[model samples]
Target chain A: MTVLDIPSGIPAHVDTPAPGDPRLARLSLNQRTTANWDLREAVEGAVAAGLPAIGLWREPVAEVGVDVARRIVDDAGLRVSSLCRGGFFTASDRAERTRAHEDNLRALDEAAGLGTKALVLVPGGLPAGDKDLAGARARAAEAIAALVPAAVVRGVTLGIEPMNPIYAADRGVISTLAQALDIAEQFAPHEVGVVVDTFHLWWEPGVYAQIARAGERIVSYQVCDWITPLPADSLLARGMMGDGHVDFPAFTRAVAAAGYTGDVEVEIFHADVWAAPGDQVIATMARRYVELVQPHL
Target chain B: MTVLDIPSGIPAHVDTPAPGDPRLARLSLNQRTTANWDLREAVEGAVAAGLPAIGLWREPVAEVGVDVARRIVDDAGLRVSSLCRGGFFTASDRAERTRAHEDNLRALDEAAGLGTKALVLVPGGLPAGDKDLAGARARAAEAIAALVPAAVVRGVTLGIEPMNPIYAADRGVISTLAQALDIAEQFAPHEVGVVVDTFHLWWEPGVYAQIARAGERIVSYQVCDWITPLPADSLLARGMMGDGHVDFPAFTRAVAAAGYTGDVEVEIFHADVWAAPGDQVIATMARRYVELVQPHL
Candidate 1:
């Protein structure tokens, strides 16, 4: 009678995979989940909570100065799964794109400085004042090409995060995980791939196939929930786990089944969730992750 | 500099194709774009604006009566691309689902009666109090199975409209065109397919490929722009063409290239756009269609 045990064989369950394999414990937390905090505080908080790894953000690193970012991370014995992001390559002019690439170069430096494994990339949104999707994508590609060598030299894999099309106008132009994979496939496997964030891709149908395609290129897996009445801004309003409709367990299984051997990171975008006491949010996250996401494993 | 020119290897514009070539003109506008009218008024407005087809909402039809809805469409030389909608199958009990099926049966009858080529199905959002996406989807698929046969008997195609994930809790469980197609493909081609509404799907990364795969099965293509700072309620604030971020012309071309020769209709979901004078809205629509989408032709 349980929802997961439908007798009809329709496969509606989110919790189909049996967990308890040691891999289940490898889940990490993307530090941006607490983007409001300073780098060292995030590291200390995450370490206190026993999260295995942390995805670091760039701004805070810069705010505290890169040297401090590196020291605090090292001092805490924390692992940097990825540097927050780089690559807002789509722009109306060449100079802007070049600037984006330059910024990415520094981001790569930051990632390398912090010993991050990958530099997450969001290939800018629809170019400002431009209506050409294809052209903007080309610009983004060129920018990435410019940044790839630095990334390679730094030993930081590029994690391309294709935002949902809702952001096609002002955010990253790479709008689907599949599109990221397509671009990544053209490069060396370790050179580029994707960071699949459930919040951005929960609405996509080809998600399963894309994740499978990403395989080794699947550098990061993130979790967040989609809430209704998108805030006027559309940047915030992310629901917590079990609050929205993503079939997380099913998604987790699909990711795991596709040979992903990385950490599972919960990265929420809700302002309210952020405003709550950090300790409370972290505790809730751990509980919900286990209660809802764990069953799938 | 044009976004449309991205990866220019593919055709930059949509092909209008020959009349009767269902592949070229696949989109159908929901007269709600002219928010101030009944079915008769919408049909007349659509024709005067030079659009070939429309999706008729039930409110308008009820106000004018089916015969009138049928007559206005016929007199104005507009194709009834689809009925406003039918579905919301997820329920707290069997009786609720039965009621939903009955309602869909009525919608199918109206679609047939109105001479529309298809019935647009907006599967109900989360059952009044459930967070189970898989369950709601299963219920919807089951409802479709029950209703598709009747739709076929009436020579009407069923177009499942996958709303954006924002509506998963209140408006629809089928939240992506690809998921709809998967369910649609499971049934006879003549009975089930999908409606690709840009307002709902523009955010999806798989929109392009799904439309291509849809080919003749793409029963409807509606358009509306996503206005950021989404309204407090999900239903209102959809932008009119040329006002928001959807790459309308490109989408039109992609659907056309895939071999859909249906009518190209604009479906806007904006309160402001809807609140404006009907004539002014139509003029803007006509202008946008000509400047943006029609150019591809």
Candidate 2:
């Protein structure tokens, strides 16, 4: 019923000693990469694979109850690198704004319970039928400001994600790292920070400059490759690490220089990877992480 | 087989007199919006619809022979507003770069031959297996510099399109109007300028500032809406005017304020629109333009 009760098996991959391996200590698999696994299994899978950490989604945390989920991972000696998400606060209606605020408060609590200081925030897209992007962005800033007190109380850093502009209409209105920083700068770095996801920000020519500018405000560094002939469904196009066009070495160097000693989380959202067995997926992810990304770190 | 020989029929839409209407004079339908139509037909269709201008694509012009294409539009009393495209300069290898340069030279010549003063340039994406976006962008700048002399000689203004960041990987590396201006500002506005397409730029927070920054450097003002459930093929997701989330009134006002008095070309790249009758498609586009976009102008 829990990751703590499961027997620890030798990892199929990562055959070398886990405790002493510097590479294994820095790698984290965001649980959505293995969407089929529940919270307990995800914790056990990461631990068994000799991975030091697992990034969590609120859905699984809510399903098992946050306390139980937190205890499960804690007992397995796995850290929750970052909580999956918390912001979608571009609502114009009073009731909707209140609901979003309540949800984010719960999300901050959940992140705190899991002991993951970072809570990723995908600032919501346009309000229904609204073409005023400027207005929507102002609302997002207000929502973030409103939630900051709660976030600070829970000891959670709200990591605002600057999604690719393609998602500007239907997803996040925070469309560039610079824009994220613009909002994040209003609060202290501990209260509000930036999520540097390579898949979203890699296309930007000035991304490196922004990464360096992020400096101590960089809460998390998420990696996934950008391959094309993208899936008909845009959400599933995040390819495995080395399978796409990202310059991982450059990204790692920039983040390292930015003074972020945080765990590097591989948060992929693809259908094929989700369909595979969790262990196989972890093995493949680990191998790719070692070959393609670990050297950069 | 040529649009030149096809009989000119009465347009199904735009029954009103054309000369006195400012909106009709300012409107132009980009040839790709009616992808199935040939050069002569696009010219004839615009003429029949009482539209004063048509945006020409190099392929259609080449199919009819550039001289013939020019004569056909000239005879129909329709102005060639702007040529569809010319840049794909971001190549890593010398041979490929040479090929791209040569092709762009031909494109500049074609724009000149078609009597369109502005040739739209989609400065290309990353080189094959290349993760160096900064390198690709630098190459694009160099390519533009190389091509500007030929452009000036041909009396063609290179209109660099700042495509949506979604296309930054595969189609156009120039992803922001600001970035386009950075490259364009190095040369005279006449030698290098910006193509302000609503579909490509509507999501940017600083677009209004950039548009004002463009000023006389704005060579063309193209319009299309950003609809959702984007075609799996990102290239075809460009919805017709007013069909999606873009604030056309705001976009029209911005360009007008920026002092661009050029034709407002309606350019949609949807599969359904492409599959329909060109005349019917033109009718719907014209209707949408008059209803949603024409008001601001």
Candidate 3:
């Protein structure tokens, strides 16, 4: 049995299960869920809600120096679940690709500093005016392979997140978990893995099989519901869990069966959720995560 | 070598190939490209442009009465390349599914009456408020199996078209050419086949291999460019060929190598294209088809 690698900060009391509440112990609130919350506030918010971990985004971590951000999460007694992002590695131009490599190295340092082993990578979309999807995908795979050594040195697992195919043009090209695993498989699971996000993948057929194939390579399992009449910009329509069409029970169960004993980061990206008070959002996220997803986990 | 299936209506003068124009001979103007044109007008337009065939939609065909529509094309010496669509087999309810089956029966009759051997099928998306994508897909497969008998009797090949993943929720459940081929493989190639549309499938990885895998089961090959910064409603933003990012040369070459010797239907759905004068739209479509796609074919 793979034991859940609990991150840095869980108070002694919280570590001991609270009567029948073992499921809540795995919850992590991704900072972007409350978009307006700064690093300190988000850490405090997760702590107040008894969430064991907090997923950090680069923007928030950078706002307060990385060291300060680390200190804030450490002080609040919350472990970092995973870093928000660290990719855009689909450029053919040598100069542009080198710049991306430089940016990824800094992202690795930030992830290591934040005390999270997982750095979620969103391999970028088509290069400007380039119509060769096959070529772009080839470049992304090469970039990931190239970054593996640097990622390993920092003790950070590069979690390649295969985004929705809808974003295959402007946002990302890795649009299926199988595709992500194909790239991640080239490296040791500890060096490179995948982030299984429900919102981006619910429509995919054979996802459960792919999840099983992901196995130890699943570095993180993020949850967010997919609501329809998708926003004109589908990227911003990720709904709160249980508020949309995703079947949480099936998803959480599949992840658990795959032996993923890690934080269930609730990473919603919706405008309405962003507008709500951070505390309220955290509370709602925690409640829904427990009610809708916890039983299956 | 599979001989190119040239449909009727080539004027004797046009049949004798002009130097360097053998590839353009297979072009079929899908009526939707000139959305303002009725059956008679579309037939006239195709003849005026020296085109041999027209792809008709059921709605416009129904308006003229299928018999009249067939007569119009026949009298104008034009052949019906393929019927627009006839599938929505994702419904879980028995009664709704039965209705879809009935509609498909009528569609087969229309295709037979119009003298087209192919019927394009856009399997419907998720049932209302349902999240079981796997279940919906299974239902679609079953529905296709059930319809095969009727389709066979009418000598109409059902061409299952895999739509873009972006439309997986509300428009179609089959999101890749591989998925469509999986369903099509169960029946004889003449009984069931697949539609290869560049607009709906350009972003897919390994598409060329899938096209080759499609082989003789490729009932129809449709072309429409995928323009980005997609309109609020993406369904209506399909650009004219060469106006978007699709690499037509590669797609056409792959289809040709697969031995698909049938009509290449220009099927743009853009609002701007729809609003243009029918003759002008047909003129532009013919030009783009020749300039951007014919060479590879």
- Name model 1 segments beyond 4 Å from true: A1-29, A259-261, A294-297, B1-29, B36-54, B71-79, B90-94, B126-142, B165-190, B201-213, B227-232, B255-262, B295-297
Structural similarity to truth (TM-score) of each candidate: 0.82, 0.94, 0.91
Provide the overall lDDT of each model, using Cα atoms, as 2-decimal numbers: 0.73, 0.85, 0.84
* DockQ values of all predictions: 0.33, 0.65, 0.46
What does each candidate score in C-alpha RMSD?
Answer: 7.9, 5.7, 7.6
Q: Is candidate 2 or candidate 3 better by DockQ?
A: 2
Report fnat for all candidates as fractions from 0 to 1: 0.45, 0.70, 0.49
Pick by DockQ: which candidate is best?
A: 2
Per-residue alpha-carbon lDDT of candidate 2 for residues A54-143, written as tens digits (9 for 90 to 100): 999999889989999988988998888899889888888989999989999989989988899999999988887888899999999999
TM-score, model 3 to reference? 0.91
Query: Candidate 3 has which clashing residue pairs, if any?
Result: B9-B77
Task: Choose 1 or 2, whichever is better by lDDT.
Answer: 2
Question: lDDT for model 3, on a 0 to 1 scale?
Answer: 0.84
lDDT of 3 at B134: 86
Tell me the docking grade of candidate 1.
acceptable
